[model samples]
Target: MIAGDPAATGRPGLLGSVWPFWVLFSAIYLMLRWPFVATGRFIDPDDELRLVQMRDLLAGQSWFDLHQYRIDPPGGVVMHWSRLVDAPLAAVQLLLRPLLGPALAEQIATVIVPLGTFAVILFLLSRLAARLVDRDLAGYCAVIAGVSFPLASQVLPTRIDHHGWQIAAALAALLGLVDRAPRRGGALAGLSIAVGMAISLELLPIAALFGAVLLLQALRGAEGRERIGAFLLAVWAGSVTAFALTRGTDLTNYCDAVSPVYLAAMTIVCAAGSSTAVFPRLTMPAYLLILAASGGLALAAIAAINPQCLAGPFSSLDPLLGTLWYDRVAEGRPLFTMNGVLVTQWLVPPLMGLGAALVLWRRASGADRALWLDYALVLAGTVLLGVVVTRSMALAAAFAAVPVAWLVRDAAQNLPKRRGIGQWAMSLAVPVLAIMPALPAQFALTGVEALSAAPAKATAGAQPRAGNAPLQAQDLAAIGNLPRATIFATFDIGPTLLRTTHHSVVATGHHRGAVPMRDVMVAFIADPAAARHIVVRHKARYVILAPDLPEISNYREFAPRGLAVRLADGEIPDWLVPVPSATTARVKTFAVRY
Candidate 1:
């Protein structure tokens, strides 16, 4: 038996025994994450954008209003985000500001809030691991989670995007699903799913999977019925509560954010769940009939209310916007299409975890079978999601830690008992390889380096200087120093410009900001006369270009004879006057000559 197995050793409750371990793991995580926090190196544009939103909130933007006024002027873009995330960030900053001063307070809040969120995720993962395996194995799982590259990347200090919170909410729901108690567990799961959906529709896939699991469990027996019924009630109530707390007063818009469509669907689901619980004696075939009827009715109701949403939120997006902006986001790409380094970074750990899960499933018996099945479901769902979009890799890595921990613990116990150098090597290698991507990453790096070495060497000198490159704070700061005016910039660079500079940007990476994003794209790829008209129409005072940006390549490809291509080829347009910069020459600025 495993060392901490409750069946064999009569251990206490999982939560009661795991508090100290959580503290230790949290401390270790803080230490691990401190460097990134201290250096203030936010990896994603989303993180910077989050800071921008938080700063705006602190500057006294209405709690219900999530518009970024700087982006589209007086009207602004309605950011499809909940104010729930901003509350904690603002509270922390306000609390710390008097003691640390404004800048320091903001920095501390940036580092601490995400780390705190990460700790909660670690605790939840540990709890799930303990239930799936044993207490000792759970500690190992926490360690694996602590070191998970994809998970860490999102939760690192200075990274304050909704993704980390969404992952936490998903894990919370997963934990609730595995909870033994019927009503309480179901409610918890329902509430978590509701909170996740309230945050963003990104959680829809996993949320739907969890709902299916609950419904299936309900169909199985009496206890399942009670759980599912409670879940449905909580989902309906929780979604309504979440929407009330987070959404703006504009209740009519069903296209983005939680609206009447979701409320109606949840209401129907609640009715179906309640019927199952109230009539537990119903036959399987009868129950199936009732469920199908209720679900179909719910779909029909939602379709009647908002047929546009039946196709999904982005259904109304222009084809050009999809082609030029949405499709190009790196996170949305498939794992197979990604470079070897990314593929290894994402797939290896999850694959290891999947292998371990399969091993455990074969050996599991009695009550443990149910627990392992839950783990398998989460692992499978997240792995499938990761295959579709690399962003889901973080979630897959997080869920994978449990089984990976089991593999490591099993190897440590059985292999080391043997008496030879080979035994030592195998045992040491197994745990190390299971925990870290270092070994597989080396193999991936070697091939990738070989394939791209010549190109890298050729472009090394032509590449922008370190300080002036897009995403560099210093470069954006230099742009900010110029008179505060609406700047027309590439889609990729817009977020950083908005976050770092005082000037309003014509476009950013957000899909909701598609109007200006489309305008900017057209301006870049259109004729000089057409581009000038767009710039003037948007009242944009400055045009900024970060040479060799990926968007520029797209622009050149789409319109070979356009102004952007001419600029790229060193042919300056007569109507645009180049502005000299003392800071860095890599970023070129042009003022429209009216």
Candidate 2:
């Protein structure tokens, strides 16, 4: 019998061992990611920008100077990212620099750090699963997590973005929630949430859910009160430390990024938790009343101080930005609207996992039942988030692996002992089903043909043509060799320009660079005369266009008679002198004549 089986006796089965499976998974991940590492193809704009940040750090930029001066010139755009992610990356690069030199050391460090994060995530998932089910089942869950497409993609080579770290923080919080030891668990969960918030506000929904769970627990009794109090203290401490260490003297910016406002809010919440812990003997009704009062006062104080934040960080976003840029971001779209393959890959495992979790919850009792309920809540919340935004699918899939592993293990164990072909096929089917959804959709579609046919319909960026290769470093190197000047380029190619060349960019995909992004959008979509005026006013020396980029479609649709449209149609204006490059140049560059 499998280790988790209720009827099993004696020693655990094959899947019970954790380290063997972890080693195997790590090997597989490295093998799969090695190709991308060799190519140095940083998949997303965020990853490329991370390398730029690291380079800046190594080049003697101040630790608190998060500004990319190359992007907006004299007064650079202040990045919304925290320096927490940079520490380890820069450390690894520094450690290896003596042996591998600068370039090679950076490449190896970039590959290793993300994969190392993947390993940590797997261990956390295993530990979380072990609490919910048996050790064997936990191992299976680790395997499922290892294979999860969305989760794995985020930590793949050169994907040094903060998304993977956010997911790790989320899982760490989950582990804390399920721990039997109240104080330690509460502290862990609180610290994880605080770290996640410090990284990015993307985890705000999950963080809220965690906060709600703690509140509910506290309402139950004194033990809950203790846990909640511990949680609050940890959050307060972690947030303050993270802020002080990362933001340094620039602590007043309370807009998009985490700032003094968040610190104040956390302090208020911590005070409430401390008060509850102090009066643990209070009646249920009185406790509830105190909680309500504390929450009301906190919200009131926050609103009074930063009324603009009540509208959310993106409240100040221009309508044109909402319509043109954010609306086009694939991850922000709902699950149903995403590509069929992604929908299949993302939705299936979670749905099955949820089903498995429900089954287990129904059978459980006492402490087990409570644990299962907590796990179920997390899974359910993530699934709901996935439905709302496609990006949350990764988190959903990671959590889903817990229960789905149980389902796979249980099914495999129940198979007949006979060595017939049917039995073998049935045994194999359990894991296969757990890994992928019904294969009818996956098998029916042709490889690149189907993806290409529905390029615009696909999530994220437009799909490249079947035979076409992506733009490489060499392609951007030529443009980088030109005179040091701000290059006006699409958001997708901006980071590449920054990485491959010494030139600065007008705008990237980051929302914090909204003003420059808006200017770029307006110039691209406006008439030639207006475009020239904006370009000259910004002192943009060169304009670079990657005509085949997915964002180009937005430019064409939004402004039919705009400069970008005319340029794409081979009507280069006299004022914009075309800079000659190799015939094979994937990007076209033009000198912006005043």
- Candidate 1, residues 1-594: lDDT per residue as tens digits? 422253422456554444665566556666776765665556677877888898998888888888888887767887888777777788999999999997888888887788778777877876677656666665677677766778877777777888888889888887778777788778888899889888888878887788777777776678877887888888888889988887746677566667878788778878886767787688888877887888898889878999888888889888888887778787887778877666766788898898787777778775566556666777888898899988888888887887888888778778848789988887887677765656667776788778877754565457543432345556766787898888887766777778767888887878788788788888888998888889888888888877667777787778888878887677787777877761345577887777
Error of 1 at 390 (Å): 1.4
Q: Per-residue lDDT for 1-594 in model 2, tens only?
A: 211333321335423455676677767766886776787776678888988998998999999999998888878888888788888899999999999899899888887888778877877776666566655565777778878888988887688988889989999988888777789889999899889889887888898788777777776668777887888888889888888889899966466767877677777778877677787678888877876777777777678778777788888888999999997788888998976877887888898888888888789886667667677777888899989988888989888887888888777777766388987887787678668764656677665576669546677765654222346766776786788898887787888888878888888888888999899999999989888988888898888877767777788888888887787677888889988862134677888887
State the displacement of the C-alpha of residue 19, model 1, in Å, after optimal TM-score superposition.
Answer: 8.1
Return model 1's CA RMSD, one decimal: 3.3
**Residue 356: error of model 1 in Å?**
2.4
The residue pairs that clash in candidate 1, if any, are: none
TM-score, cand. 2 vs. native: 0.91
Computed on alpha carbons, the lDDT of every model, listed in order, comes to 0.77, 0.79
The candidate 2 region of ten consecutive residues with least summed lDDT is 1-10
- Model 1 has a clash total of 0
TM-score of each: 0.91, 0.91
